[model samples]
Target: APLGISNRDFLQQRKVIFDFPTKGVTYMHFKSIEHPEKPLVKGIVRAETIISGYIIEQIQDDPPITQLTVISQNDIKGLIPKYLVNLASGKAPKQWIGNLINGC
Candidate 1:
């Protein structure tokens, strides 16, 4: 299996692991999750943002990429980097703060 664990095991181990923002909470300068290979766009989180909900969805049955979904305000579904996302807490890293502030 891609994930090394069987599907049944993966599902059994699955838990709400990340500190997901509440359905409507706005995250400032939210990065795009859809395209990892391409440059990321700095997105502003607003009340009107159309996030379907944060979820760790299974992309591949084998060697699964730890991808998370981020629905845009325009209702477009995008993928987020699982590594950057703090599964333990929803806190942004210090480096991300600088990037967000400087628009780096």
Candidate 2:
């Protein structure tokens, strides 16, 4: 008679584990959850551009995030990451200015 295998045994056999880095995913396009009527958000890649005289402000590139492109409708099960979703939703990002004089 053959013995039954446990969940752990199955996992071990499959070599599955929750050991992966989830940080520094800088570039990624996310779909919109707020407005279904609108199109999917496009992720923008930031680049340096010299304007006027000084380097300031960032702009979105034409190409969307490569990682996001792989994601299918089914992959986006629920509300996706806010940053990524912003592209499609046309949402504004949080802004904060520091006061050098006051040290804010």
Candidate 3:
């Protein structure tokens, strides 16, 4: 989700933490939106982890989307878009600090 990533790759590799609002379950993965014809793996997070840094790139479509990229402790890379992210308790990347403070 860096500044110059393509939309296809952005959608395929962004990390997302999915919290089941009513089920009390949490899942984390490199999110891939479900497609109609073929099924793609939704990177499911099975362990507890904290993401320290993120590279975010946003796309302004009819429904704007944000791409989130993270490098895991094991050196694995993951990506997810903003719409798929649950921002309730998550913090924005360092690059976004100024924008957040400016109320943008």
Candidate 4:
């Protein structure tokens, strides 16, 4: 039910939402290295197609590293814009951060 209308898939007719209860656990939030700006995309982690799923972890803000967990992986193909994904994957443009804060 998290699906909604957006410019990304408005004409493609691709649903941003996937079926619920991804994997054995339900994802409350997700942080993508491929879409850092799109932080905490709320949804369920699918049971299948895990390799491309999200990795979950709790870390201290001070030092940043902590216990990392692969909470769930999702098929967020069209959900996250490719530009944001590129940013998340480190292939980001020079103004990625600026663009993120300023909104794409």
lDDT of 3: 0.40
Which lDDT tens digits does candidate 2 get at residues 33-85? Answer: 33345433444222111111111222334653222112222122243455654
lDDT of 1 by residue, 1-104 (tens): 12322221100111243333544333332332433344333452212223333344444657865444443332222343454333412442344345645993
TM-score list, all predictions: 0.19, 0.14, 0.20, 0.19
Q: Which ten residues in a row have the lowest lDDT in candidate 1?
A: 5-14
Tens digit per residue, CA lDDT, model 4, 1-104:
22452222111111222323443322334232333444433443322233332233444557765442333333445455666655545532234445644994
Candidate 4, position 35, lDDT: 35
Candidate 2 regions exceeding 4 Å error are 1-23, 27-29, 34-69, 74-104
Select the stronger candidate by TM-score from 1 and 3.
3
Give the poorly placed runs of model 3, Cα more than 4 Å off.
1-52, 74-104
lDDT, ranked from best to worst:
3, 4, 1, 2
* Residue-level lDDT tens digits of model 3 in 8-85: 222233444444322323334443343455443354322223333344455455697765554433212345454434
Sorted by TM-score, highest first, which candidate order results?
Answer: 3, 1, 4, 2
Worst 10 residues of 3 by lDDT: 4-13
Q: Which structure is stronger by TM-score: 1 or 4?
A: 1
Pairs that collide, model 3: 13-79, 14-79, 14-80, 15-79, 15-80
